[model samples]
Target: MSSEATIRRGVRNSRYAAIPNHVFEDSRLSMEARWLLSYLLSKPDNWTVVIGDIIKKGNCGRDKARGMIAELVKFGYAEREQQRADGKFGSSVLVIFDEPRDSHAAEIVGETSGVAFLPQTDLPATVSPSPVPPSPVKSAHSNNLDSANTDCQKEREGARAGSEESDTSVVEDRKRIERDFKAWYRTWPTSLNDSEQAARDAWAALTPEERAACIERTPTFISAVKAIKGKFTFSSVYLKGKAWEKLDDPKSEVALPTVHNPFSRAWMAGMLAILLRPPLTANMPAPTKFQLGQIAQGGDEADAVRIDRLQKYGWPRVNTMHQRAFDRQGVTVPPPLVAISEGFEQVHRDADLAKRWKRAFERRGWPWLPNTGHEWFFFPAGEPDEALAKFSEATARERGDDDAA
Candidate 1:
């Protein structure tokens, strides 16, 4: 058994900010991006946090923070705008989660922030904070002291520092809200996908928990709807109704799986059912162009191996077939056994039927490719006939091994 390990950490006031669990659980973000997101959420309202401050406080280099910020903005988790150093109207504001529509500034006064940020492991506590508000009662008491001017001077200096910290916090917060807005804009699924403005309003109306829940369930809901519709797009669900709100409890559980039956396919007489692709009824197109990516493991090297397998085994068998008879007449009918196998497959979707037919055909040294969606042409194989015969023998032996077990 491993020993329990204790870790030491530094205390910071930013820990006061609450971070929701959903942000961390999001599969769309990287660890660094998520941590930066939490840090921005921890700042006081209306503060401007500069990149330099993030670099310094985040304990990360300039390039890393920049890249993380770029990634966040790209995915709609953060936003940024240029600001002029000369005091102007363009100064950034960390306007909580959403842009206020009807709520007056006076109304929101003293209201706690809807978003709270707490630091994660490998992240620094980010709440440098706004300058502390002056205590009116203390100022009144200090007025009686003879050294009031000195006290006032010290307070002024402290306020300036606080103002700077507050500005940094605000800047970071604005970036965070911008990300939230962008994320909503890009990801909100609807039935009739119009009215960006209405979407924004609906998004703002949702509580943080509701928004998080919607994001979590978006994929599952989209998939379930698509399986039922036969032709579903994000727009199919998104372009018509406010399906996002209904995502809190998904009604259907069905999901269309990968539309292929690659296993239980075999060779018969010298014929093999090398490909057993199923029809795609979902919004995605039937595969028009065949590539290794279609049947690949999706890594660069693995894809290369799949391509090699195709080139080595697949293309050669296709190339050497005798097409002379079909070219001369346009129809070279399969021998009697091949015709019967083709007829049987026309009405059945059974894998066992395909495999048994394939094995029986292979025993006679012919492999069978089905005619579910493509034209089947007959041709003579010189060398592959023997190759396919051996292939069938190996398959038969393997099946025997299974049966014996």
Candidate 2:
């Protein structure tokens, strides 16, 4: 029987996927991976699945689904590209079956006619300036207001201090809109090319009214994608397609996944780097990654600064390396830096362990003290379990002697 015929027997509806058979047979591919591939394969060509769609449909968390898809791509079983989505760049994820059986070819679907999608162009060289508002005449009456009403009068000052505040508001509003758009943009299932700069330019082109509308419907887009149901409107797609017009439609709310934060994400990466295993030394508790952000925090920096602010409130600041060193109760090894310190390559020598390891080295016909430039054994910066073992054996013998006495 053909692959399509067998798949149809298992699935009642055409919408439901029929996974490929070889995927299960390949012992290296995990079941989760197989399912993800099947899901992508079942879709029409150029069909995009956002991160939220994977989370919802795959019954997994946002990060897990993202990581799984990344592994799928990394393992060379999938290909992802950014192509035109209604004239703006959008992700196209496809299953890669290098040796796909002839029967499996019919399962995949889509029209490859390039006529509908045009390559996304950068921002136009010039933007038409917003219509200048007619100057408002400040009434002499505002000048007569008492101290209590002074703020009101100052706010109404035409084309002076008040105008400055209005301009500030416009700039700040654009910033807020861009920040929100980035939050949604980064959650895409695949990465983009020149995403940050491109997003900024597209965002600037949006009218104030359209920007507001897009912000309003962002939550709806988020919720719909998480349901694995509607088409996702990414920031680039929104800019090109004028998707803000669709915000008027009612949408059902689905509980949102933990939103992505570039800063907290860095922190979580540092946190997940906490490895405890044989290759690790007590001195080297897994290194954490926390690069200090820019000093001036504004615009897109809002989310990172907010997270750092919260982190400061919860966890007291300290010299992390020093704290780790003190906790380990072990001396530091010469860190391999590019400066003069890089020459400090003398390995740590635990005196007691070294004495015990010396005998073992000799017993094993390994060099303990050799000629100059020979591979003389020093305490390993990595796992030194053998040293510990010999020390334990010596102590055991001493205890035995005491018991006989």
Candidate 3:
């Protein structure tokens, strides 16, 4: 029979539902299957075509086109009508089943005969008997099929087991390396800070693998240590070099200059205190005569002197003079510096009388006569009382304001 005739006969006897919407929802379907379905549905009969034509028109590989055809059949959307050519040279034709077979057959028959065949609603739901129990020989064949399925399952399980074991080993190795590296980094700094002999003692304790891992994971170790300590202050050249190397970008060609034996903030503070002397007797020695003159000026020049001293001594005081000068010409010092100086002046003023009294007593003899009853009061008696009272009043006011806030 012709491909179309065979399809029509099959449709007449076939009892199957229309293709479900969920089947085509899969994203894996190739572009060919989508086009093929739409093209076949447009025609009334299942058209036969060479598989090669499908591949060419679909713009896909032959294997891909074949896979798409197989998918459509598996999903109940299409069927293949295969034919064996009898000593013919021509390619075998493929008939695609487009619409639900029963529906198409009913429509075709109704159109040809001019009679509509209404589906029977009152017909009993018939359930066909399960296929006859397998014969003894067929039963043996079924057992062989089961054994084959079991073997295939076992092979798949073994492959999965091998993969899982490798993955577990990798995970354990990673965890162990991480633990060892953390412990090593914590102890590594001690060795770097120690004497040559002490460092050798510590280095000898570490394993070769641990040393390699430490080098590899230095950046991570530095970051973790910084987080735990809140800040990292390198005190020596060796520590600085190690830190820089750990944080350095490997892709860059230029090498950074190394810093050695970093200066302390305390050292800077002492140097600054010496450079910017107040009008006090127990003052630190000035670094230069110009700095001394600047300190004597007691305004912007005084601040400049202080800042210069601080910076020279390695303290990082923010340079506000440039910004201040930009905003308002002739304004040499910033407002923050002015505020700080004002606070200092207030403190000095509060202690002025006590300071004067103490100095006076030290230089000159006691003011009270030796025979007078006041000689028993050895320390400065009434001089600091007013200043102390004012200080207490100011402190109370400040506390009250803070509490209100």
For lDDT, the strongest prediction is 1
Off by over 4 Å in 1: 1-16, 82-405
RMSD list, candidates in order: 24.1, 28.5, 26.1
Tens-place lDDT per residue, model 2, 1-405, is 111100001111133354445544444457787777766656432232334345556878756776776655665555544334477643342434422323333222112222212333644234332243111212221121121112222232221233656556545654665586687566543326436655555654454565666667666656545444455544566565665444332222222222212112211112111111012123333222332333244454544444444333322211232233234322211101111121122332445554565554433322232222323223323234553353334333222221110
Q: Ten residues in a row with the worst lDDT in model 1?
A: 1-10
| 1-405 per-residue lDDT for model 3 (tens digits) | 211111111221123433323223333345567566554444322222334334545767657767876765654555544443475432222334433334554354345443234454656335342242111111111111111112221221222223666446545544554465445545545544545433332332233443465456555655544433434443232232344343333221112212211111111112112222222223334558877887888897886666445443321221222222233312222111222222222112225653564444223222211121111111212343443344334333222221110
In model 3, residue pairs whose N, Cα or C atoms come closer than 3 Å (at least 3 residues apart or on different chains), thus clashing, are: none
lDDT for position 190 in model 2: 33
In candidate 3 the C-alpha lDDT for residue 239 amounts to 34
- Using lDDT as the measure, name the better of candidate 1 and candidate 2: 1
Q: After superposition, how far is residue 113 of candidate 2 from its true place, in Å?
A: 34
User: C-alpha displacement of 377 in model 2, angstroms?
Assistant: 73
What TM-score would every model get versus the actual structure? 0.21, 0.21, 0.19
Tell me how far the alpha carbon of residue 181 in candidate 3 is from the true structure, in angstroms, after superposition: 75
State the TM-score for model 3.
0.19
**Clashes by residue pair, model 2:** none
Task: Give the poorly placed runs of model 3, Cα more than 4 Å off.
Answer: 1-31, 44-46, 84-93, 99-405
Model 3 gets an lDDT of 0.35
